[model samples]
Target chain A: MDERAALDLVGGLVGRAGDDAAVVDGTVVTTDMLHESTDFPAGTTRYTAGWRAVGASLSDVAAMGAEATAAVAVYGAPAFDAADLEAFLSGARDVCERVDAEYVGGDLDGHDEFTVASTALGETDDPVTRAGATADDVVCVTGGLGRSAAALRAFDAGDVDRANDLFQFTPRVAAGRALAPYATAMMDSSDGLARSLHQLAAASDCTIDVDEAAVPAVDAVADYATDDADAREMTVFFGEDFELVCTLPDDEIATARDACPVELTVVGDVTGDTAAASSDGAVTVGGDALPDRGFTHGD
Target chain B: MDERAALDLVGGLVGRAGDDAAVVDGTVVTTDMLHESTDFPAGTTRYTAGWRAVGASLSDVAAMGAEATAAVAVYGAPAFDAADLEAFLSGARDVCERVDAEYVGGDLDGHDEFTVASTALGETDDPVTRAGATADDVVCVTGGLGRSAAALRAFDAGDVDRANDLFQFTPRVAAGRALAPYATAMMDSSDGLARSLHQLAAASDCTIDVDEAAVPAVDAVADYATDDADAREMTVFFGEDFELVCTLPDDEIATARDACPVELTVVGDVTGDTAAASSDGAVTVGGDALPDRGFTHGD
Candidate 1:
């Protein structure tokens, strides 16, 4: 099968394959996505590279409303030296500890090219699944969207400082935990807000309608989007924001935000229909009678 | 640096920096080695392929004197179909249940070649470590060695049934647990009997000496050796024997054997000075002069 088909098949299997952490009784660990097709630039900040890996793995656990408890990292690094390897491990450990997780023992090997993989075990008493959203639930974001996208634009324009702040992001573990009890459906916005919402919508068997004006944008993104609507569009479509997006009952929105203490903005509401459309008629979650545009492996 | 130097440096750093799960005051989950460099055939045995992957991982926890609790598998398969992927997962889940470990979660991706990695966790009060051996300790093995090596040879020679029995081997978890308290030092012989003894000896700051005659050898391996000396040599040098070789106080040998109820053999004894040597007159263990002949990645 092609990459997309393989992803769908694997995703479906894992989704149905019980919980992520079976030993913890209430915990579940799911393999959200794994593709060897994304391009990570060489000479990128090593710290950021390490953070990217940890964040990627942790985000999956967070998406399930589970707090990461431990992680096992397996990487295939060719000709890597002691210092580089140490830095990589340190980075992973730092992230794990920051998120209140342990960096467990792992395997290492030499490969022709660099390949990093991790299995994160998480624990939770109540798991907020993507299939639990209901009509009239408020779709909320844990933090600002499109900043990472804007950072990428700045990076492409050689704005290193601006890009570093945005690209080197952390997962919203604390925010996810705070919202887990109240949120009906939860997921991390890795494949941009639009695509993630589309997934949440599909999984919940409902539609999501986002208010363009309500979707929070960073100041830097607004600056970058000045006179470039396409760039803004790309920011909404291509950005991996590394933030939690959850749908909760409209009544619980205030309480959830108060408990979370995060800058959560109500970007949309869940609908009974299976469509995901934007209010301004210029954007779509899954797309307007077309397919959603998100990060595709091997694209 | 050479592979040995690299390994030493990396291993030392990992040992120091990585959390000493074995040393920590908690249940330790360990798994055995599944090296593409040694263990399984390079081709064929699709069903056994996943088993080899999951089995190797689960074996570590099994050898740790702890019951298998949970596992996370990371694999790289090149252009594998959904069916193949499902079969692989099914095989992994089968082994997980066999070991009483839960298949918690994992990661998967495509690569230039097929690679399988797994991390298993288990719980026990305190883990058996390799640094507990002492001088005057009797060296013993839980099960027969050279079976895996024999299986490899048979598979290569198209002896399917014989190879299957040998290659698809089960670990001595019961024996490991039974001998945990009696064992002065313990480690699974993944990198051959000679090398594993050397590791245990070095870790425990003692010396190990194996009698060439007492070291067990499979019939096929014995026949392949052409003579007793050759058989002994193969038993010493050939790797991928996942048997538990432990050193215990001389007085506990009888009790350990009775408790384990396996084909326990007292191969040798630990000494204050270097004495372990192979049938070929080369010092294989204990002596500082012995050459490192165990498996090395990228060799």
Candidate 2:
């Protein structure tokens, strides 16, 4: 079975399958893994690896509108330099502090290649899962998308500095907290906008239609867009934006957006229909089918 | 820096560095990593891999005397057969079931080698840690030791079945829970009995001396022990036993042991001394130094 199939098998026990984190007895728990070979490109540094790995899991905490409490990492590598390990741990500690969480110590072991598995523990009084949206709910996203996609492109093109800069994303914790009280459904848009919409649709049992031109396109991806390609596709199809996608009742959108510390853009609305399926259900623009596009590990 | 040194660097934030799991707001969190190359022997089955990975982390929960609630795994491996993945998940699920914990969903990614990183979340009203032993406490252990060490020897000799049987250990969750209220300090003997004693002494600032003959030794290791080799060293040096080594008050030893489901062995006592250092503090029969012995990855 593939990853998704494995998830489906365990979905009955964990509850919401595609949600960023699982809530168990008031605790929001999430884990992420990063293999140096596939996750870190040639230009990546150990410091960045530690920071990005911890931050990615922390982003899941944000998606659940939880305050991160503590994090632990299990690091596996053949051998590490004393300085590199220290710097890597420093990066993890710094990132946890950035999200106002404690960095707990974890296990270390030897492996042929460098691999890090990080878990973030969080707590939330009123978590917002991706299962409450209804018809006419306004769908909004925090910040812009396609930054990481653009960064990957830049890295491939040897613009290492720009790529690194673009990959250093803030986890939108404050915005998620602000929207938690108002949002009906919420998730992190790390797996691309289109995929997020599909997941939200499936969870909330509603159809999410995006006005393609309405998506706030970041400038980094604009230079990479061709005439035949829609610049929004970069934002919708490629991921790692770490932005929060939330659906709020129309009456609550104004207050949620106003209370949010970051830029919140309303880009779509939910409709009740059997339109969440791929066969003629979702559309990106006029008569254009919205295909599922994004990243899935092991795919 | 070594693993312990790296933990000491982050010790300020998390408080106790070597505890089985970190407790935050009544929740217990711990993580463990397993790589196929070093962790798994040549003929290790995928089913055993998943069981051992999840079971290893759960053993930590047992060390803390916490009841496990949920577990998540981050599996990264080169393309695996569908049957292998299914068996792996089944193994994970079965292990969690054995401990009465939920097999919550986890992350899956593709990597060059098989790597499973598992984290277990647990809870307890009164958690037992490794820093509370007093000078007069009687040091005791749950279950016999040297099973894993002997298993390794068997594995080296092409006795895969015996190795697997010996390696499949029962985590002392029940025993730990029974001892939690009475024991002053506790930890898993996965790193070996001598190393565990040294750690307990270091954490509690006391000295522990073993009456060599009184220490329990499994027959599996006795067959492998040489004439000159001390029986206690066989149980102390090699690791991965998953037994609980605890310090209890002399007044409470009888009741604690009687209450424990696992067989209990009293091998030593706690004394006030600064001589617990590796050079000469610990001693066995005839004043022979019980040197530090156990596994350290990549050492």
Candidate 3:
């Protein structure tokens, strides 16, 4: 099956398996992939690469309005050295400490290639799922988007110095917590802004209209995007953004923004339909006419 | 790194990561691998196979002397059909239910080939470790050994019917619980009896002597062995036997056996040396001359 069908089947099984944190009561666990399709370097040994994987996984739990409690990582290594494994573990430990999430036990096995699987567990009074948004809700982002993608481009072009800071981007944990009480729907934008917006809209059974001009883009991407079209495309379709995209009541958005003080952007509004289109009329978030350029398994 | 070094490093990391069931402070947890190396089909599957991948993992936690609490499964699937994925999940779910373990959230990704990684958590009052055996401790087993290995051989030889029941051997949870209060040092023997005895001796810093007559073998295996010598070889070297090899004070061994009447065997005694030799002057258990012949990764 394709990604959509596979996801549907998995979602059904997961639902039956138990509710969120169903396996262990009083805990909510979430998982996300930092894969070659989205994250770069193709292996586990790049500088701060392991941290990115742990951070991306933790970000998923944080987006659900939970404080990360523990993490279980399964790494696939093919002909990897002891030093490389130590580096990966060290980086993961650092991230775990930073988030106050303990590094729980996990497994290591050999494979034909290398991949990192990180699962983060957290605790919360009530998790903020993706299906709580309502019509007339204001959509907001916790931090800037398109920077990680821009960093990838910079790294690929040997501009590592310019992308160094962006490469180690931190997940917006504080912002997620601050908005959790106010936001009705929450999810991390690992699969890019447009696709994530479409996901949030579909999950909440609401339409979202993005004010394209209001969405943030990295300055480096603007320099590379020779025209506005390229810049818009990069900002919309580029993956590994790791920004918190939330929908809240219009009144609560202002209060939430004031309390969090991150780069909260009111880039859209939730409507009553299942559509996610751009207000500028130039870009469409989930239009059939647009290409399916988001990250996919085996892509 | 080689398997020994890898195990050492991983053991150290796990030690530092936290103790068993440390995630839930009040609970105790244990873990084991039902690795593809020993428990899988001779041929590859579109997806990974065997309930043991899930069963053995949960059994470790169960033998920890704990109840199956939660589990996180990491699956590596080849580029294959969705039906295979569903089948793998179904098998894993079946084991989870059998052990009363809930299927917690985990990671799933595509790989160059298929593999399965399962981590199970259990709850106990005081956790059991491999280093708790004392000198003059009597060793015992939960069930018969050499059956799984014999089953594998039979299956390989195209006698599936002969091995079917043996292949689906259930973990001795009731027996383990009955024996836990008395077991000084304990571990499930996934490796061969000889290797597991060696491991227990190394961990407890003691010698273990096994009586050849005490070691159990299948009737078919005895018939196939022609004599005691062949049966002894198969019993010593054969792997994937998930029997609990445990040690208890000699006086307490009878109590343990009486608590669970399951043909408890007086396989050996724990001594203050680093050697483990069998009785009947046949094979030494932890002799330095023997080459390690159990299942190994990347073999």
Best by DockQ: 2
Clash tally for model 1: 14
Question: Alpha-carbon error at B136 in model 2, in Å?
Answer: 2.4
Best by lDDT: 2
Q: Please list, in the order the candidates appear, how each scores on TM-score for chain B only.
A: 0.84, 0.92, 0.81
Q: What's the TM-score of chain A alone for every prediction? A: 0.85, 0.92, 0.85
The second chain of candidate 1 has a TM-score of 0.84
Q: lDDT winner between 1 and 2, please give it.
A: 2
**1 or 2, greater by TM-score:** 2
Query: If the candidates were sorted by their DockQ against the true structure, best first, what order would they fall in?
Result: 2, 3, 1
What ranges in model 3 sit over 4 Å off? A16-23, A30-49, A159-167, A171-174, A218-220, A223-227, A258-262, A273-293, B17-39, B42-50, B104-107, B160-178, B218-234, B258-266, B273-293
Q: Which structure among the candidates has the greatest TM-score?
A: 2
Q: List the residue pairs that clash in candidate 2.
A: none
For all candidates in order, the CA lDDT equals 0.65, 0.79, 0.65
> Could you give me the TM-score of model 2 versus the true structure?
0.92
Q: Report DockQ per prediction, comma-separated.
A: 0.29, 0.53, 0.33
